[model samples]
Target: MDRNLGMDFVRATEAAALSSGRWVGKGDRHAVDQAACEAMRRTLGDIDMKGVVVIGEGERDEAPMLYIGEELGTGNGYAVQIAVDPVEGTNLVATGQPGAISVVAAAIEGEGKLLRAPDIYMDKLVVGPAAKGAVDITLPPRMNLKVIAKSLGKEVQDLTVGMLDRPRHEQLIREIRQAGARIRLVSDGDLSLALEALDPQGEIDVLMGIGGAPEGVLSAAAALCMGGEIQARLVFRNEQERERAKQLLGTEDVDRVLTMEDLAWGNVVFAATGITGGNLLGGVRYTGWGAITHSVVMRSRSGTIRWLETHHHFHHDPRY
Candidate 1:
């Protein structure tokens, strides 16, 4: 994969963030998501690559654009597989909360291994490099917390776990509390929280519980670049979802654990731009003549992370 392509990926995220940032706190999640999806699709077409959407917003019937199997980019460069979330936290953006982001991950086709995650719920466990070999998705929540705490050379009480605040997580949350570990319950955007655990300066020590399987793949790309770890398994709530999973994965074994390599492997690029600030990156700041965007771009091949702060002059460029 070309190193310069990483910057182009950032540009796509920045465009999506700039377009969706305006709708923050507007209480219209659909509008915000649509704005981001449109911006991302348009910007991605300008990049010089033959891209296939391995994991995306949804199937062609569910989403208007950026759907799975959709071809992106101009037909002029390297062939790649893409995973994207134009708006990671639509509710957060709608309610004027934090942790909304525009994310993209890419791997060179035929060279890298990319998972086509089914559009279903997935139970996930994530830890940073320090605790990579300690946590396991198959273990009980309390046991995994203990292992991670020990790996970090801290007591269970000193570790903090981040999880989505949903009804399905009640049992998981109780187990974490029983283990004497602190918890941060977020309204949405588990992807950002998962990435936050990779940063030593961040407060989140681990991310647990269920989230979108597509987001799990996106998080795996970032984890691969940061030397973090992710373990996930698909969950089917009913027969309809189970049938859908069988069709997508071409198998009946939904109990299998998906590791980082199973999600995203080989040389990969991950990029994200913040729409609302929280732990990982700052939100977009608007000025009189232009707006500033903050983003992170990383490559798994080199284990290199780049923080980009770009100033977009809307007046100078009609594209904005």
Candidate 2:
């Protein structure tokens, strides 16, 4: 893929964020998600790539646009695989909460190993560069936390693990607390938390427990760029989901642990724009005539991370 494609990915995310940011605090999640998805599709249409939506909103019947297997971009550039979450935390944006983001990840057509992640739950463990080889998903939460703490030159009691605050994670949360690690329970958007753990200066020490498999792959792309680590295993909730996984992946053995390279390999690019305020990036700020968007774009080949604060003149920008 062309190096310039990284910035083009950022533009798509920025358009999604800017479009959905308008619906913040509207208490309508479906509307906000639809707005973001539409904006992302529109922006992606202008880019120069023959892209396939490997991971996206859902299957063709579930979503109106940006669905799995959907083709995007101008078809004049290199062929690539795209993974996108137009509004990662729709509930957050709807309730006027924070940590909502528009994220996209891409890999050159035949060069990268893009995981065709099924729309199901996945167990994930993410850590920063310092603890890259120290933590393991197969280990218990307490044991993993101990190893991570040792790597970071801290005690287990000082480590903080971020995860979703859901009923399914009740036992996982208990185990972490028993292991003497502090917990940051978020209502949604574990991908942002995973990325935060990959930042050395960030507050999160690790991200664990179950999340969307597609989000896991997207997070893995960013983690690979940062020299971080993510270990994931698909968790088939039932027989139907398992059968769907087999049909999608062409296998019944769903117990394989996917490393960062397995999720997103080769020269990968990741881009994310904040729609609401959070730890990694600030939310969109609306001025009288324009809005400012905060986004981060990273590439694995060059290990380049760019933080952009763009000023969008709403009157001049027809996309918004």
Candidate no. 2 TM-score: 0.96
Per-residue lDDT of 205-310 in model 1, one digit per residue for the tens? 9999999899899989999989999999988889988888888778878678989888889989999999998777888889998899899999999889998888
How does residue 313 of candidate 2 score in lDDT?
Answer: 88
Which stretches in model 1 have alpha-carbon errors above 4 Å?
60-65, 318-320
> Candidate 1 deviates by what RMSD?
1.7
Quote each prediction's TM-score: 0.96, 0.96
**Which segments of model 2 are wrong by more than 4 Å?**
60-65, 318-320
The candidate that achieves the highest TM-score relative to the unseen native structure: 2
lDDT of 2 by residue, 174-290 (tens): 898888899999999999999899999889999999999999999899898899999999998799888998898888677888888778889899999999999889999999988
Residue pairs in steric clash, candidate 2? none
